[model samples]
Target: MMLTNAVLCLLIGYVGSHGRQEMFSVLVCIQTVVFVCCETVLYDAGLYRWQLFIITCVIAAYTFQRLHLSKKLPLRLSCFCMSLYLSKATIVLIEHFVFHPNKVPVYSYVTILFLVFMIIRIFVTEFDTNAHSFTGHLGLLCVSVIVNANPLIYVLSSYIFMTESAASDIAGLCSMVCGVLIIIAQSIHVPEDLRVRYTGVLGIFLGLVFIVFRPNLTPTLYSVFQWIEVFSVISFVIVMVTDSVTQFLQIMLCSAVLGLCPGFRAAIMLYPEDNIPVSGVLLFMLSSCIITCIILCFIKAQHLKHTFEKRFIKMSTMLAVVSMVAVISDISTRENHQMFLTLPSLKLILCANLVISICLKLLALRQIGELLPLTEPKDDKEVPYLPTIGNIATFISFVMICLMAPTSSFYHDVWCCGASLVLVCLQKDMRIFSSLREDNQTTATKITSLVILVTATLYRSDIWNYNSSWMFARGVTEIILVLFSIPNCYILWGLLYDNVLVLNEQIVIFTLPLNFPLILYSSSYTGWALAAAGIVSSIWMMFAKFALQPYHDDY
Candidate 1:
């Protein structure tokens, strides 16, 4: 009865709120679990998490919009889409388990379903989008291409097997290079805007054909065809970075993965290092990173660095991904269980660079108050970010990174120094700081907040590792933290609602109802104590803002 009720409630919510993908996804997942749990039918691997996710979502579709299943045949568009995703899934599972290089993948078939819907919607939907949202969607399509390119990537990267083996002797390395170039050519356009992501399904389709034939790939150069498909995905992403809102978020998410993620398990395999020659791929990646940084430096020179910063972060982040994966590989080269070995030095260098660069960015941002002309007027939303208490909390995370891992190459250390200097001298105007009283006062307030927050972080972290197992055991501390954390999220949502209209608009335009769940779920740091802290922090901030309301007149 309980299971039935949950499914029914979930069903209504999912259909009524079809716009919210995350919630809908969650509801479907839950309903699937409940149905499977309560069923008299025996549990099998077939009805497991991944399969259940899809089966449940389909059931929900049947319950609400019966046409979804009825209109589509057994080998329907949705099924085909699901098949493509499962192909990628098979590749992922194979790669993940074989190499033991990174993370354990718990993939759901629903991801494929999501991709299928995306393809249909991209061309068919009359959805309204800001320029950013539109571009972001294209960027995501490019990402999907990368995700789907697992087999080709595996083949191209598999030089050890290809070069040493008699089977690959027929294809030859030069042939591989040519094939890749052709694919790149087909996927791209001279003018970035000329690319089309609507043909994503087509690209995937062709790539499958190419993958199947690329081994012999003789008469029509099938390998070459696959390469073009891959290129199209890449080109679409490039276009997205140049002009999408969702693209920016995608960039940020990737950065977060690079900056905070400790292992390769979760990292997207762009060009798998294993199959490709180490020297070539590394050089190619390095060259791209340098070119990207230089382009961003030019934008900084012009003082038009807002959007450019996001790009810089994304490029650096992807390269850093390769570096981080290398770091993980070094640890577990002998046994798959090598994630145990922690390198403090390399982590220190990474942590230091991230910390210093963030500081430089923050320092430069502080000068905004001094330089701004009150007469020029400013949108509250556009007010340059002055680091907040949350930022300070995140900084504690960097400190944790340094403490947890040990490694510091001279090259990596140099990155820290270079990024710091770049932050300071990145812009001629950024180098300028004023001796104004208000500036000093503002600096003091921020510093004070930072010190307090860092102290809190230090205190929490001190006991965390010591009682780490106990902490994971779940108890009063954890529950309190969870409860307290929700209010902070509420506060966060309030702030986002008031000040981040542009971001919200972009999410709304492209992401559907998922935007709301995203806002709701952004309070990821919520835990027993953390939740309490958020509630207290938000209430205090509100009170403080109320008190300071009258002072806005003076400013």
Candidate 2:
């Protein structure tokens, strides 16, 4: 009954969501139905977790029939389904044997919700319709599943020593056999042509350790073994899925797996009965040490200092950033403002990281700009300055909105200026703009405008502290402005990408008026009337000047 309700709620929520693909929606519904029905039938029949495991394998085969994934469907299903079911079984086994709470927490529903969200995020952000890329995303999804499933595996195995002697022996022997079979299957699936042949052998070795350590499983030992199995499964899947070999995907895979270990360890520590004395810190350090060793070996073998070295450094730096953020969050929650203030080191580190990240990103963007092929200078009359006019109109509308908005919290209007700057910077014909440049005048205008904008950003918080009543008014005005500008921005953004020629650098001159208005307007009827006038005129000018123009490439 509990399972049925959870599954039903999940399905209903999935169906009602906006912008979902039909195939994805159907796949989710079918999977949920199968999961609920299988649990219901198997539980009523008094089946062991092992029987449900076999049932999971059957479901995996059925899923492949529905989805029709190419290349090593059995192996993919085995890794995916086994990890999923093992976690499920581990939860059941622990509840039955170790600890039982009176009430099942609402957290299962939360878990399902999270699972759905992750599926959507992965599909939206990463997956494309291309088959190879889809396979890579699928492989990533499987790795995530394995990583998330590890905590349950640890909890189930943590107290193996405390179980009834005969039960422990039976469970140990069964686990040993299961591990061996998994390892053997993983080994066989490896292609013989690859020079890097030891992945399967390494998996086999990890499985053997799990088998050997089953008799005296401590919390620490169990966690170690579980991580090994989890990483081994990920490695095997990466090997089988050819498309997951790119540096970016590999970084994501490794980070997701290694990054969550602290959280998993901390969760166990948080529970009273489930509290394990093992240190999350030590576990993290161990994982890092192992990763570092592996990376060193790979670097030595590949000898791509330009590629691997840079990526590894970036990843390691990001990992440190994550750790710092975690520490700062932990400290802030304790309400120790004095300690936080005293820590100049933390502040310095954060500032340095911020500056470094910004510089690196700008460098990357500049490199990309350099690589873009130069296009032939088409006739200026081909595509009119329709986009530029639209942008100018929107900029005027935003300025009006800023003036009408409350004096407090008005710095958010700088976002409009930033948006305008982005449009200017992205112009492909950077050299063409210099022809329109009027000696030192444009440069002076740009510098003056930039300094003023930066000053506003630096002191906006303090400025808001002087008055609190404007807060609600500020939100209302901003929303109105956003609604007004969104259509205009969309049109202008499309125009920029359409390879049109226009005065790019002159957009920077508009920054002056964008920043100058904060000094002039009161949040009164007169201010609002002027704002309304600006909005109407700009939108009217946009449509009147550009709407009928055949500026679009297709037209």
Candidate 3:
């Protein structure tokens, strides 16, 4: 609420009569921060002072207009800010792909800093201890500023001479800034509620700047999503326990990439033909994510008396992935008699890479288990625990994506983006199948969940999109066009499912006929399958959660 008041004050101050003075001040603050980050980190993202001035003026004008309204706007301001951000980011992304093909797209300084500020605000709202929350938030902001400033310093310093080390120095400096931030932030014991809230934003930006930046880092579904769980779930615990900025940075970077599977796929598809094998490995990693989820779910289910075969689940999943790879390879090789790629070799290579990955991960998990707990309970009796159902259903949705290998055809980019947002914002107690457990509903929870789900559903349905069509039959542009079908089943499901993410009387009635083969066959097999799996999984997990409650003696 303090943060809310501060934002209101800040908003009101900008809109009031002394507009230019205050408005210009924020621009100066942003530019100064940008200059510092560029000079220090050598991350020379395009930041024209004139452009900053223009954007500042535009936003200020909009704020002034909005301030004329008597009532306060919740999503309007935030969504306005985010919509502008998405526009800028999209422009940047397009520019990166077109003009600057090699370089990763960097975000605007305002967006980055705003996210940092947002993280702090979220912590204030979620965490109980005022001192820790305030200081923790400040420390995070400080680290972001310092780290960003270092990059600016390095970039400006390199303008003197075209020396390569200067650039490397900048990149290293930026990396170091991230490292320093993590170390400092972790020094304090951040509270539990705040950690969960902060991780979603942190994980994303970190993923943008840090994790995906690694030269040799391979994209795997398991690795990427697990990384998300770290920021979304584990980071919350770490923040609560150690409160280290260093660890938090790592968690944030991880989470950012988790929801970016479609982006990652696009990246892989663009890789050189020789590196096609890498795509398979990347995909296998994605499948292995299910394995990891299965492991987590199985453990939880066993403790809670849910039935899932340990050996069979493991073997079946592996075999299914392997069999699919084999099938794809056979079809690909046969089809490639006149094409560019040898699908069979790539498939074999991918499977091999995946198997090796699983073994290595098993080894890593063996040792890392001691360093982390599976889950951290918040406020002993307040925030209900996230059951195995939520995790499993989400995994199911994800697994379907991999199984069908949905391209822009069915599970379009919008769908991927939607699901990812819902996931990263998901609470420890909320299941992907249902909504917030009544034992732990907060105002923030409703707002965050509502925004993500609504956005995701719209995106998933391709309602806001202009070129949304389904391709069912092979050759000719055969498709289903249902753009903006309002008062939709998805909305109803969201409303009903939001309260309890599992199977119950309400879910069973809605989900029963919904999951039948007829409806499933209606949409693109690949897209709808994943969507249906997500829905069905939610129901299954919820029912199973209740059934297994008697068995969970340890938890």
lDDT of 1 by residue, 1-555 (tens): 455857666674656456444454444445444554443132222333444445544554344333234432222333343334334344344444444422323342334334444444353333335457665655554444344333333444464444422322323332333333334433442124434333443444444434333444345655454444444334434534454323344444433322221222112233234533344334333433333342333223224334544444445455555555555544444234434434322442344345434543554455465542212334855533322311332344344443443334323322322322222212222113322223232332322232333233333332345456554443334333333333344334433334222222222223223223322322222122232334454555555432333323544
Better of 2 and 3 by TM-score: 3
Give lDDT tens digits, candidate 3, residues 1-555.
334445655664565445554454344334333433332233233334434534644574355335424233333343344334334433343334434532422543454445444443433223334665655665565455455443243444355335643333454345444544544444433434455335444534443333243322257865564345434443333433342423323333443444244324433543445545544545444544433343333223323221222332444456456547644644443433433333433433334334333332342233243332333334655532323333343434433333333455434533444444323222333333244443433423333333333333334442233343342231121122112111233433444445433323444344444334323333344434434544554465446533433434666
After the best TM-score superposition of candidate 3, give how far the Cα of residue 68 lies from its true spot, in angstroms. 50
Report the Cα lDDT for residue 462, model 3: 27
lDDT of 1 at 249: 45
Give the 10-residue window scoring lowest on summed lDDT in candidate 3.
474-483
Best by TM-score: 3
List where candidate 3 sits over 4 angstroms from the true fold. 1-130, 133-137, 140-179, 185-267, 270-315, 318-555
Which residue runs does candidate 1 get wrong by more than 4 Å? 1-299, 303-307, 316-379, 382-397, 400-555
Candidate 3 local lDDT, residue 205: 49
Residue 447 in candidate 3 has what lDDT?
32
| Model 3 residue 529 lDDT score | 46
